[model samples]
Target: MRLEAVGRRYRARGPWVLRGIDLDVPEGALLRVEGGNGSGKSTLLRLLAGIDVPTTGRITGRPRTAYVPERFAATLPFDAAGYLVHMGRVHGLCGRQAAARTEEWLERFGITGFAGTALDRLSKGTAQKVAVAQALLAEPELLVLDEAWAGLDTAARALLDEAVTERVAAGGTAVYVDHDPRRLAEAVPRRHRVAAGRLTDGPGGADEMARVVIEAEGTGEPPAALPPHSWTAGPAAGAPGLLRIRVPADRADAALRALLDADPPWHIRAVRSTGGTSPSGAVR
Candidate 1:
């Protein structure tokens, strides 16, 4: 997929979220979008997914791309399996195939119990898993995810990483939006920052990237285990209640689990990265 000078504005009076953005994602490559909120990250994903039309420039790609937004789109009363079945049907999958895939993904994400639970009743992480499962069911040529890993636990996050890897290995492409550089460093090898209607490569010079983030679950403490290689610790921005532990790509999972299992309130939230090496002092 290739995007050139892509721009989008919902209203004439409002400022454009994306302006003059140019990007090229080769087949089977993982591309990550990074930026603060309202920085056009979601807008870009929407444009790429063809959910919203752009007011300026053009995007050239397959139209059947699978898009997973930051929020759940299914009705509140629907079960995870039901929602997946509906989505799969829309994507031309047979009833039996949809059911099989739904069951497989739900179990893989460690949410088998959620198969029958209403979307509204499921926890935030579980709902997110359903959303991801639906996207995967389509077997899209291009997978575009917006905050795809937000609110997920460590195990769920690992499942997502593996899913992306599998899809790419099948010659599919992915475009993800995230804010956690550490996760991106581990999952992706390339990074781009969105700002003022523009997109530019940021951090790491690689073509693929990976990143992850672990957050607190109300009253819980952050994880203590750090990623392998070089790691650094410091206060998280605008989050006095937590600390940011940056880890290298090699030991990210171990460091993350150790921290979460330390019996503190920490929970793995999201991961993003440029698939780069973490700084030294990452592990302790």
Candidate 2:
């Protein structure tokens, strides 16, 4: 999806909330939008989600979209499961499919016990879970989250993070706004900031940082001084004792040195860049 010189304002002559904006929402991409309060971040998200129309310019190639706004209506009449099923149907799922997805997301969000409870009867956090679940149930091509993590519990927040990653990995696009800078930090995602009704690239823009993935293993624990901004995870399925580390391209050498210098030393299996060929100094 793409936005070309998009602009928005409330009234015929009202001051613009966003203006002269151009953006590309590519498939399989994770994008973060940031800004101070009243800086029009939400407006841009709304436009991306097709919740609000642009007052000027054109937006093209929008796909099946879902949005979770900053606030959800907790007073809706339907029970949680019923509301989600209804939303799934609205997103074009069949009845049985909708019900199945409703159950799936309820369990994923750890809210299966609240399935039969009325929306208005749920607590704020549970209500937020419902809001998030509704959006995810559809597996939308475009997901727009406006502080969708605010009221979620820690577990739920983590689940949402995984869900967003899954969506992007599945060839969907996710555009979100969150107050936490550490959100999806491991992805090293593309970022943009809104200020004075305009959008600009943020720090760590996609082109500015390339990532390197290192696969290694050792009996001892990892080094205490791993490179900054790097993250480690357990190896892929069937690879016990293996560790996967991702670091910025520039720090790949430092991370490899740290792992190799550790007690008992880590054995390097592979090192490759996420965006192209193996980086320089990669070990096999």
Candidate 3:
């Protein structure tokens, strides 16, 4: 998908929140966007997700997308499961399919115990899980996560990390905005920023490593099939017995396969792009 000279503003002559924003979000791309408060980062994401339209110029080639806004109201009338099932049907799934996926995602996010609760009554973390689950229900071609992990618990956050990797591995695009610099410090993703109502290139942070971080918890030696420089393992953060594997992006597929196909399956926790410059403007 591509954007050409896109611009957006509130009124006929109001200050533009975004202008001359040209972007190329290719298939299978993992992109991270960074910017300061009020720098139009959210606006750019909104445009990309089709929540809003450009006031001037053109945007084309948009793909099937799913977006998780930074803040989602939990006061909706429907209960958690009902809302997800309704949204699933809206996204074209049959009632049975929707119910099954809803139950599956709730389980994945550790929220099945609360699936029947009213949305407004659930904890903030549970609400966030619902939001994320709704977005992932359809396996959209384009995934837009705007601070989607803010209220998640440790396991749920790790689940989201895994979800993004699976999407990219399947030749889908996933764009995300997060305050934490280390959110995906292992997946060498393309980085950009919003500044002065425009998307520009500048220094965000250190973008030297082109590696993917794979997490698994088990006892095993690094696979011999992987290039010497393509993989390394260590204890993953926040979880004992979990191993974090770092590998060159080009070799991630093979490395992941080798690890998963080992004699004893290495339970994969998360995989993400790491080492990026997070600043107002991104630089090569």
lDDT of 3 by residue, 9-69 (tens): 9899899899888887777667889999999888888988999999998889999899999
Residue 251, model 3: Cα distance from true site in angstroms: 4.1
TM-score winner among the candidates?
2
lDDT of each: 0.68, 0.84, 0.78
Residue-pair clashes per candidate: 46, 0, 14
Candidate with maximal lDDT: 2
Query: What TM-score do all the candidates reach, one by one?
Result: 0.69, 0.76, 0.75
> Between which residue pairs do clashes occur in model 2?
none
Candidate 1 deviation (Cα RMSD) = 12.5
List candidate 2 stretches off by more than 4 Å.
Answer: 209-284
Candidate 1 clash figure, as a count: 46
Q: What is the lDDT of residue 217 in candidate 1?
A: 33
- lDDT over C-alpha atoms for residue 130 of model 1: 88
